[model samples]
Target: MSWPEGYGRLVLAQVDSTNAEAARRAPGLAGPEWILARAQSAARGRRGRAWAMPEGNFAATLVMRLDEPPEHRALRSFVAALALFDAVGALVGDDAGLALKWPNDVLLNGGKLAGILLESLGPHLAIGVGVNLIAAPGAGQVEPGALRPVSLLGETGVRVGPEAMLEALAGAYAAREAAFVTYGFGAIRTAWLARAMGIGAVATARTARDETTGTFETVDEAGHLVLKTAKGRVAIAAADVFF
Candidate 1:
């Protein structure tokens, strides 16, 4: 199939981590933007954890070159999240029980519908996204409080085809990329916060060092989750928050 302007081509494989495959192919590719994968055998999420990807799930990775400085890299995650949110929302419904979690997670009715992983590949970056189209895998299952994972078909009673989802994602991503390049991360930041799952609610997060319980503040311009704890406001760069 002929890919859209921003998207070069969709490379589908039976199995392999899209992020890992994209990382390996990024150096030899001519352009900076291309998507690869059909399913992931060993998908990964934040904190170097594995993301379960069974058949019928949507697994893909987008490779792109950013002109922005290193400090602004987090904007890419916001953009990717916005794209997935918009695409999935359009397919299901505006109020399709969809919400964007901090960093890059797509939640449906308070459960995880999709998750994104962004990794640096030399001068380029690979943004990997996994969505539960039919069934969600039962690996790396976390606690059941706030940050629980859900699936698309499980929520909407509608089976979203992987190819269709990819098309929508590519289109949404292209539009968001153009806006990010032209207007900067301000626009994306505003939209992301608007679709955020919990803004002023209390949440709990665990990191490698310690655990934090605080109010969910707005995501800062740098894409860090700003939390208001008893001591003071702390900017969390990486941590899984339980809403």
Candidate 2:
């Protein structure tokens, strides 16, 4: 019916985008609500890429208000990414191959397993998370070194559902949210880098403006993607990362 604590719950059969629903209903919401759906006809990933999510997979958005200003609240993406890591780890057992990508992507066995998208709503925020649980889309023609889409069922032969993921996600997020509030992003950054993929490795980042080739450096305290390019260490606040 509802989450144990922190977030309220609204499960839908289908919607355009959970984030869109969150934005529409965020004003009337009391505190926080996990807006989940079985299928999304218009799921959008980073860079507005069309996310092909079938009925078996999970697509949800968590709507909430952050008193902290937008700049600071943006750091919550790291927190949510880490929380989902913990949740997936709990389901499949933590493995060395599983890692977090820069910004907000979760990788499994070197493939893309999950992604988190944060959309700001003035003082509020919409944290959209998508997980490949039962079914995964084909790699379809991706660039070299690009991550292929993977699903838990394909990787572990285990079938997890949105209901189970929401429970574990809420619990995992509570702890990480507390750590973020108490200690700050510095603490979270350390843990994130520990499980980060492609750090210290040569990679390329494509932003809206330009693309830069460099070594994937560390993320800053403010959660910017740090890169070691010919121009020296550059902090990218927003970009699509690739290796």
Candidate 3:
């Protein structure tokens, strides 16, 4: 695959976490960069949860400096999700079982296939992505009631190396980035909603202190998840969603 133009790339045998590596290099970067780790000994998910990075899985971070409002920067999660949807769809040669979950998760055949985490490192924003391309963690490894982890190979018999996955992902990300920069988030939001899963269905969103059960509605202009609850329509900034 052709690497995207104007994007820097680094492949490592291993790392503590690709996000950590990006934070170290962010200050020196002149443009967007992708850092890929074949293995991560101390990777993490949101809220400081440990992330599993088995051999052959895809672990990488995209670091870039942006001059925009916090809300605009936050929208990159949707941008990254769309890029991943495109990249994985290309691998499986169809979009049959692919769906994008709210906040930051990719579903394949109704199971969690990948996850995205965004962190602000001083002046740059780091978007870390992990995909189960070869093997998924056991059901016991995840939280209770969480969707079972799934792998591309196990689900579709598509075996892809981490490096190759980065190539496709980077190219897809570049295109999505261009769209976001040019047309603003409205275009990206529409595209994301089209591929989003579980619209008009009942789901539960759990936050730190409380849980809200409501019918899934569209994501708002500010990227807040809108839900139609028994009380009224609610816009949630962040939550763990379950259908």
Candidate 4:
């Protein structure tokens, strides 16, 4: 597969973490870059939770410098989610059971298939992605009440190696990124909600201090989770959503 143009690419046999590597290389990057690792010894997910990297899974980070506001930059999580959804669907040649969860997760057959994490590195942003292509942690490995993890191979019986997955993902991301930069988040948000799971359903958003239980309304233009509760409409800036 052809790599995306105007983007730097690197593949490592081993690394402490792709995101960490991105940070180390961000200062020297001339443009957006993708860092892929065969193995990561110190990987992490959102909220600094440990992220498991089984052999043959997909672990990569896209480091790019954007001159947008932090809020706009943060919306790239949705962009990444859409890219992952497209890439994986293309690989399996089907998207029947694929869906995107709020915040930063990609779901397959109602299970967590992949996750996206965004971190700031001075002027650059590191968008770390982890996909379960071959193996996934057991349900017990995740926090209680979290969605059970699933893998592409396990769910679809289609095996994809890290490099091949990166090619698809990078291209997909580049397309989505271009659209986002040109048309803004309006189109991206609309597209995301079309594939989003749990819209108009009752769900709960658990923040650090409180848990808000309400019907999943819609994701606002600012990328906040809008929920319709008995009290009124609430827009959650950040939270762990549960259905």
Candidate 5:
């Protein structure tokens, strides 16, 4: 299949972290490339959480040189989530219980099936993507407070290999990125909210200081999650959400 313009591919038998590899190699690298690893020893998720990517699961990071502004860079996480949601839909079908959690998470059957981590170095951003394809982490394997982990294999009784997932993801990302460039985050936000997992539900968002409980409202124009509590609308930029 044809890849996105300017994209190349790389595979590693093993790597401590594909994102770290991308961060190191992107500066010297010429164009975008997808770096995938069979196993990750030091994988990580948002907020310094240790991400457990077992051997059979999928670990991939897209390395690309980006010269966009800081605000534009911030929007990439949402764009990435939408792209990944598309990829998941391809495997599980659009009618499946695949939904996107704001910022960077994909939910399958109301459980987390994938995560995204974005790291920037100069003009380059290493967008790391980890999906649970063959299996989700067994109990006592993952960090606390992760959305109950689920896997495509467990949900659909089918094992879609990592290579095929990557191919679909790359294509989906290219298409979504194009739409983002042309129409901006407004369009992306609309599509994301359509497949959003929790909009009317009550959820708690814990920040560094304290946690706030509210009705999960819509994500605002700037992409901040808008929560409606007794004290009007709370615009949350960063928090761990629990439903």
Candidate 6:
């Protein structure tokens, strides 16, 4: 599919933190939807963790200036995750065992295939994404699963290029943004829950103060994970979920 107009002037580089670089360039950039991509990376996910971006992996960031306030900023991360899902699903097919984990992680056959990170740079938000297109690196392993983080080429035996995936993502993000604008967060929430990994599964949530075990319920409108614990329904804004 063709990319949206004015979204293709990507700044390609050999190495840099996609999130950092995007944030640095966001203030000076006149366009709202500019992309930055690199062949390798030195930075990783949440909490300044380390992520290994090999030559074959896809590391990119898109900077967007939204009209909404900071309280609703989390919606951009959801949009980014859904966009990445659509892009990877298109290359590997819908039945490729792709699913979305809450707060922004893409799973393929119950293994992490991609991760989304969102950072706010003043009024603009930089949405960074890393996808395992060829090989899954071990430097940033978080958990183990049956699939062991299969890539697009490994799962489908097809080499998917980074440019093509970025184009697809841009299109998907446009569609998602349109839906969010017209119908509000309800539309995206439904789509996200449909492909959610732990919506109906029993899982453990590790929060800062306490850890709770409960069955995963649907995400609320404000973008919090609603867990049905033995005691009652708990709305968690931040936590690590494990099954």
- The digit string of per-residue lDDT tens for model 4 on 1-243 reads 477899999999999999999999999999999999999999999899999999999999999998878998999999999999999998899999999999999999999999999999989999999999999998878988899999999999999999999999999999999999899999999999999999999999997799999999999999999999999999999999999
- Return model 6's CA RMSD, one decimal: 2.1
| Inter-residue clash pairs, candidate 6 | none
Q: Between the candidate structures 2 and 3, which one is better when assessed by TM-score?
A: 3
Give all TM-scores, in the order shown. Answer: 0.92, 0.94, 0.98, 0.99, 0.95, 0.92
Tens-digit lDDT string for candidate 1 (1-243): 234674576566765687787777777777755565666677788878778776788888888766557667767889999999988987776655788888788888888889898888778788888899888766357544535567888888878888888888888888888899899888999999989988999988778789888999888878889989999998888788877
Off by over 4 Å in 3: none
lDDT of 2 by residue, 35-81 (tens): 99988988988877778796689898989988877779888888998
For every model shown, the clashing-pair count is: 1, 0, 0, 0, 0, 0
Model 4 residue runs over 4 Å out of place are none
What are the lDDT figures for the candidates, one per model?
0.80, 0.86, 0.94, 0.95, 0.86, 0.77
Give the least accurate 10-residue stretch of model 6, judged by summed lDDT.
139-148
Name the 10 consecutive residues with the lowest summed lDDT in model 5.
138-147
Error of model 3, residue 8, in angstroms: 0.2
User: Which regions of candidate 1 deviate over 4 angstroms?
Assistant: 1-3, 143-146
3 or 5, which is superior by TM-score?
3
Output candidate 5 Cα RMSD. 1.5
Best by lDDT: 4
Which residue window of length 10 is worst by lDDT in model 2?
137-146
**lDDT (C-alpha) at residue 10 in model 2:** 90
Q: How do the residues 197-223 of candidate 5 rate in per-residue lDDT, one tens digit apiece? A: 789999888877999889998988777
Can you list the residue pairs that collide in candidate 2? Answer: none
